[model samples]
Target chain A: MTFTHQSGTAPASTEASVPYLRLRAVTKQYPTGGGVAGVDLTVAKGDMLVLLGPSGCGKTTLLRTLAGLLQPDSGAIELDGQDLVSVPTFRRNISMVFQTWALFPTMTVRDNVAFGLKMRHVGKQDRNERVARALELVGLTEFADRLPRQLSGGQQQRVAVARAIVVEPRLILMDEPLSSLDHRIRVQLRAQLKDLQRGLGLTGVYVTHDHTEALALGDRIAVMDAGRIVELGRPVDVFARPTRRYTAEFLGLANVVDVSADGGGYRTAAGARIPDDVIAGRSDVVAVALRPDCVRLSQTDDGGTPGVVRVVEYQPGGVLHDVELTGGARLQALTPVGLSYSIDTPVFVTPEWSKAVPLAD
Target chain B: MGRERVRYPAFAICFTLLLLVPLVVVVATAVNPGAYIKFPPDGFTLDWFTTAVETPRFQSSLLLSLRIAVIASVVGLALTIPTAVAITRGRRRLRPWVSTATVLPLITPDMLLALGLLIMLVQIGMASSLIGLVLGHVLIGMPLAVQVLVAALSGVDENVEQAAQTLGASRATAFVRVTLPAILPAIGSAAVFLFIFSFDNVSISLFLSAPGQTTLPITMFQYLEYNSDPTVSAMSTILIVLSLVVAVVLSRLGGLSHLAGSPTRRSS
Candidate 1:
């Protein structure tokens, strides 16, 4: 089987001019518990790489390693070419925003944002200027004198972001900073964070479990699983053509169809023969997978499998209608906005051959 | 069958009666006009109060006890806070053992610990003195402080400290800036408990107090043994009042009872 990058896909941009930080085969093991496995990553200056995975996947550990909070048991970390493996977290010239917002309860917002500058012994005039700029960036200037407890959760999170950036460190790390916010606040802050990252040209390593956030915020996204980075590429590429079966399944729920090797191409479980030209065997498993959006419904006479609509869910963006075919295999179809469809309607479900790729476990 | 009610009023009345007996006797003895102890006074006067305050021995012993208690508690807090933080900050494997070791002092018999300390001090040529007494008080005070600090540290959001570290604060700085403030209420409660333990320490002081370094409890014990007079009652009244004042101060500082009343003093 041959592998191919689909046509009309946008080519990834050239590498960033200056490499801000590089984690060379970094591996962290707890001796008593599992931690991040071998991780090879290069975060360029002004680049944002979001580590996306579920809990216990070690995305947080990778971010912490970058911030020098937790030292990698193996491999070297180079910051702007100089090895920072042994450098302490405080001296790493890196800042991090935690999931908890971590604003200093004793200090007002001003002080919390100014703490990094103070620790670095920044002059008072310059410190004030940077602190004010950061607070203004986060739209928290009015709450500068308020203690952290006095601010709302979103406001506190913004302050945490402001505090990390106030010192204008070369790199910033955020571990699910918006995960604790309400849905509305999360949506609002996501746009704000993207705007801030662009405005400041900040190099950031953001760890998150949400794919939407990862796709929206990260220039390059790394999907991790079981302590290892299973897939890493541009957000679009990772989403559109995942390298591993795990990657395809994790990005979104892809309907996986097991196929057996036939004389020329392959045969679906239902004994339907598929030609070789369609199955781009990228993985070892003899299964073809397609996104729900790829599965289309039409009249049975129009070269589609006979099926009955089992369930119809009207989502905000589209209607997700599941079709149970005569062969007993279920397929889901995403009918876009303004599409007319109803439950229990007899329909024909056909998989989009162009996007279906062979899957592996 | 429905559960039987607790009869809270009966319990409250019994508790009040039990506590009122001592308070009433102490007040009556202090006000009695008689020079000696009596159940019922001929008349009321404040002579014993005046006499108790004027006594140089009582005044000196009180001052010495206050000084020892203050020093001991301060030292004990210094030891406990770091250990508590260490316990809270340690790996999962180490956390349990460290927490258990810190609280072991509270579980062990105070008399046995005091005897052991006295023997150790004597072996080191540190005889009964203010320093030895202070050390003994710290031994008794430390468990209370640790218990309080551990509870306080446990209540502190670990994420806050981790956030601090992310925001350019070192572990120590993060603790001082974030963890300490969050746990200040617990620390305040701990301080009150250590103060009480140190101020009223009898078993440790009995073994450790020097001739001139006698603490208030030691002096009170001596006076009670020698003569069951109204003066002792006056002293007890003063102690009760002092304890009440401290309790109020602590409550104002941090709602100490709320913290102390928790079943899990040191959260795992």
Candidate 2:
């Protein structure tokens, strides 16, 4: 079968589109203070919500809570408009692909895939057929009889995915499933997984510390920091208009300028007042974040901030210019390689105002 | 790399000689034509083996010991596998206590446990019977079984069990299907230890066993105390050979060293 993955978005036919799952103020806490605290979100059917964050940021805890591995302390979890707060894990009809691919070492690949079906008491013939189909779905039909140890790491991960999807669960949880893999393998598996998720039209919750993975794979991304979601939105929206400084800086390598109002616009550290519509009050101190792609180097463009190129480092596809402003503050910008200027060379750095976002405290 | 000719250390050679000298002497004394404990045999013969088999007292005692050891080991296995699993899979706080408690049998003095059992068994009117002997053996053997099992449990990748659970197997199913197979070698080692401990137990049987219920070790003690003969030497040699056979068999299944107290063993 051809791989199919429809880009998840708010469908036009809202009347027919229902949420697959919903977490209503779900809060999970441990005695040690390391758990998800008061999370509220709804996942549309077939939507992949990627919980992206640093380590110990409650992404895994949230995923576990969703999977019923850990119950929320004081909130309701609903599946298809039905309350699942009291439901046992096995009966939750939710599957989880653990961070460590937990393949049974003794059982054959086929048996591992067949396990959930057997648990649900599927008949012998039907279970065998579904197992074969599941293996084929993961492109492991020829490896059905092999033990997990016999397969490569990527293959074992695929088996885990297959075992999860074979049950046709209402929702699936993956906890940094690709973090343990080599970069190349991770890329390959991510694409394969996205395709499989779309083809199956399964709702998924993926947890990872990798912002790139979140950007590339999620229909909606939730940027979590210190057990709370600092920002959650479409990947483009969150990256383009981060509501919090941590979210903005975390999504990419960013450069920030502490700006104060001067005249009709904001004056940067270099005393250059860039034009903007957002007003700053006496109590409001603002930081402006600019992505590298939004900053351009100019040797003679007198319209922008005047600075001296203090250092230039050659990167793989580009060269990074560390420009020192008149006030002794520094800003970094990446330009294509071979676009050159010597250190101590006079230059003007221009920020693309359209790409600049005023960060929340 | 240069081909290096390795030489055995002097201490290693001395240790090997120190252990082997008595072993050789015991074997020689067992087969000696003269019915006495001697380093050199007057002539080679199978008379001791024949004598050991034909003597009803020795034969019955051997059977009793074998039966007691087998029962104790099997019972110990039944208790240890589940307890070890519970302890390993338990909540963090419960785990430490359960683990330490299971090993309490190993840490406590054997004479004290034997005495405690003796007092309890006498109150229950079970002392000086095969049941009492079996109970004594289990008390001595269980800790070994638990130790071996815990070591085996530790070697298993917990991810394997989680995988099974996610694949629709219940926690119990995952244990039977995944955890059990991974720890089979550890279980084997535990079984061997339990059998050895049960077979060699003296204090427990001293408090528990009646005249006919005496195990081979107990009977050997009685025989050695009465008469200094080649019979006791022959028995000790046989027990040593049995131990070696068990070790070889276990190693064949998987290297026994892997099942021994590996660093990973402590965690599980």
Candidate 3:
């Protein structure tokens, strides 16, 4: 597997540059056998690194460990050149926004936001000013005096953000913070969270299962599977050129075709000749994966390999056709919404050669 | 709908009347002008009420009962809150056993428990003393306190306390500022329940109380065995009124319905 740098952004700084937060060999093993396994991650100052994975993939475990809520069995977590593994949660100088919003229902929004300041012995006047500013940042100034239970779900989440940001800790950790909101509200809050992080120059580690959210929010994305990170790179790089079969399939970009060397050229399992440039410098290429978006379909069987349309799925702006080759292998291709084809329609499928990614196994 | 409404009210009235008739009779007997305990008083008089108050035996017993109840409830709370927290937040494997141990007293026969406690106290040379009486009451009241507290703690979101810790509050401070207030209503109800159970208890008090440490209920039971005066009626009425005050206060604080897991009604 190889990575194509489509986004043209430089990679994260190496350890010689003194990253703001550094985690080395963090490992926490649960009795049930699926926990964080020897994870090493680093985040530069004012950058957001998103831990993206499906549920039970140890993404939350990693975030919680960073927040000091869970102790790694053996690891060194350092922030600003200070080791924090032995520090208790309260003294870690970190803030977390929970998925459930976790606001104190008994206290009004103002009190909830001021709780951290009060604990740190911040003066009353200064605490009030900070709380007011935090609330305004989240657009929740008018709901300050109301109890958390009295607010809507989105409003409660905003109050949670205000409470987290008011403390102004060294780092902020968010665990699927927008997972509980409706899609529309989630999109709105996502933008707000991104802007807030950038405006304040906050260093953060966000965890989520949504790829779209990761792409939109992360300066770098770490895609985890099982208990370890399978791929880590810029969002576009990871999405377009996943380094492993699991990463490719997990990111919904797998259209793997078994190929073999036939005489001087490569042919798929269905005996269709693969263009030479697509298999360029590889003598040991056994299979290739193409993204669905990179495959094109035409109604006439004159341009490329011929297949029958098996299923047509309607997406928001386009449609996907599952085309079955004569060799009994199926592949999906995307087409414009104006083009509608019934199942069993004979069509030709062509994979854009430049976008074909070679697979190892 | 109209017929159903009328039928509901009718049933409620009948049920309420059945409960109120005996209490009315007791109050009527207390106010009787005659010395003997008779309903439909010959004339209204304050003699029985005054007599019940003036009696030295009743006075000391009332003080003893109040002291015992307060001590028992406080001790019960001290023992049960940690137990409830452990049961709620500890390992999943131990939860079932912890729950059973806390609720054991509710199903065990009081006489059996009292007998065991009496023997234990006697062996320890603390029988028939204030300490022995309080110990017994605490045992009986602990189950009630633990049950209510466990319910309240389970309803609380654990993340709120974690959030507090990340906000610079220590573990102890987080619990005091977040978990404690969240379960305050349940604690209030449990205290009231422990107090009432200890104050009105007779069977456990029977084995635990010495000659001078007799509680109000034990004293009243002994008095009723010997005399037929209206003094006991007056004492019962006073106890009933005290309990009513506690109930009203508890309801005003919205503790009762909260313990039952119902949404509390707001008074306009």
Candidate 4:
């Protein structure tokens, strides 16, 4: 699939309504360094906005600012037209699911779920029914009598989710809630979590360092780097077409090479001649991102870029090949399972030109 | 069968004998027929036991020690809760200094602390008073309580408290409801330790005792100064029995292991 598109921008919300959550020019500086700076974002009602970045990128700081856990040095945060900056964390009526699960070890699952209602002085009868409803929502009613420690890690996170939603909070903030679970369970829970959100029409902002989680779960992905949103768009748009070099590399488009326009073609760093068709009609294309899946391999000289397969790794549905071009540039290609090529096998690499996304940096 | 297995039982027997010897001697001397404390067959009599129990000075001093221990442990525990929370959760990185300063009173000689406290108390006109004794005991008991609490508090995730607060709990309510219950076992253990620490304390009490307001340990030490009688031995036996009960209860509360720096038994 060739991804040919112009520079990307955040699409208008599908509902065409006012944003439910807004952060404007939020900056928090630390004397010892590594804090968020000048962050601006918006999430329409019922949207699941994901903040994805590496460690120390201040995704957490931004989330904390929204939750009123950390006061930003400058800027405003508004949720549902009310200024969250002036709101105390406890009064914000926002629930956060931490990576630690944060279940009360002393309390039984039912009491843990009912904690939010109890804090609000809800009558016992009302609190109990809501608590039971929440347990059934997460399918943990059978384990309601068990303490948090007695439950498995995945069960505990479900309890945390139940506890978070039972309050019917204004906005839910999840800080890598599923990151602590094992891979098999994480995927399963992520689908259910999204379903729960949509079923309730809940507005949420989730932070995670895992890019796959961002691409898989986000209604709209905000790619953050160095405490700044480098790019913001829907998952399909961002993954298929990234405008910056960082976004392409971070999103697994790893075959990025420096290029210079020469006549009607562009000359790659390793001296390979790529025709103007891959340039996407850009007069100032300095680099290109060739996704591994976009490249194809063959045993014959198919007039494609010639390279030797240095490594071939068999994956479930396909084989991943790392090929070193004759011009000394290396590119990775994924082929179907039966396409097996051992090491040092000379192969033709055909990167689909239309799918080769150009980078401005 | 194996040398390693054989060595373990041998060490266990030796350890048991070491603990039992003093207890057996104390029990024997408490029943000594002679005026002086003695082991072997001096003939058995319960006269000294009655004398130790019936004596007014002993009775009053025991009551005084009980009162001081309860007061000091309660106040010291209340004081250290904030200190522990500050060191464990404070945004600043002064934890090293704060932690070291908290335990300083534990390592500094109790006698020196008593002496310093006495001089300061005299300046404030509180010398040789019950307040002086309690002040000294709190200084002694606070370090252990703070250590237990800091370990317990740090084991609790900040997110747990945040989870509560975000659910509409005020800051104080979150701590009292979520955090306090999570570390309740450690708090129980810390309280038990502080109580026991102040109960048998003599070094600080001896220096700080008001006239005629001495504690049980001070009274025992004073009685032994001139008399070689076995009444003190009888009192020692009674105390040994009480201590045995306290030790069992302490173990049940997990105080003994907690004193050895056990962080938490709960899984993360």
TM-score winner, 2 or 3: 3
Return whichever of 2 and 3 wins on DockQ: 3
DockQ of 2: 0.41
Q: Alpha-carbon error at A25 in model 4, in Å?
A: 0.7
lDDT of 3 at A163: 90
Across A1-361, the per-residue lDDT of candidate 4 in tens digits comes to: 0011111322333662688898999999888888888989999987889998888888999988888788999999998888999999999999989889888878999999999988888899988988888888899999999998888889999999999998888899999999988999999999888777777777889999888788777889898888889889898888887877788877774588778877778877766666667775887678888777788888888878889999888877588899999878789998887777889999998876566778876
By summed lDDT, the worst window of 10 consecutive residues in model 1 chain B runs over: B259-268
Interface RMS for model 2: 5.1
Show the colliding residue pairs in model 2.
Answer: A116-B167
Clashing pairs in 4: A2-A355
Q: Candidate 2: lDDT of A69?
A: 65
lDDT of 2 by residue, B1-268 (tens): 1225879999999998998887888888888878676777888887787776676778888898888889988888888888888777778788878877877878899999999998998899988877888877887877767766776677677866765665566778877877887788777777777888898888888888886677888888888888766777777777889888987986654434543555132111
Residue B265 alpha-carbon offset, candidate 2, angstroms: 13
Q: Rank by DockQ, descending?
A: 4, 3, 2, 1
DockQ of each: 0.35, 0.41, 0.51, 0.70
What is the DockQ (computed on Cα atoms) for candidate 3? Answer: 0.51
lDDT of 4 at A267: 75
* Worst 10 contiguous positions by lDDT, candidate 1 chain A: A1-10
Ranking by lDDT: 3, 4, 1, 2
Q: Which stretches of candidate 1 lie over 4 Å from their true place?
A: A1-18, A273-275, A280-285, A298-303, A326-328, A336-346, A358-361, B1-21, B39-42, B255-268
Docking class of 3: medium
Distance from true position, residue A249, model 2, in Å?
A: 1.5
Q: Which of the numbered candidates is closest to the native, going by highest DockQ?
A: 4
Model 4 reproduces a share of the real contacts of 0.80
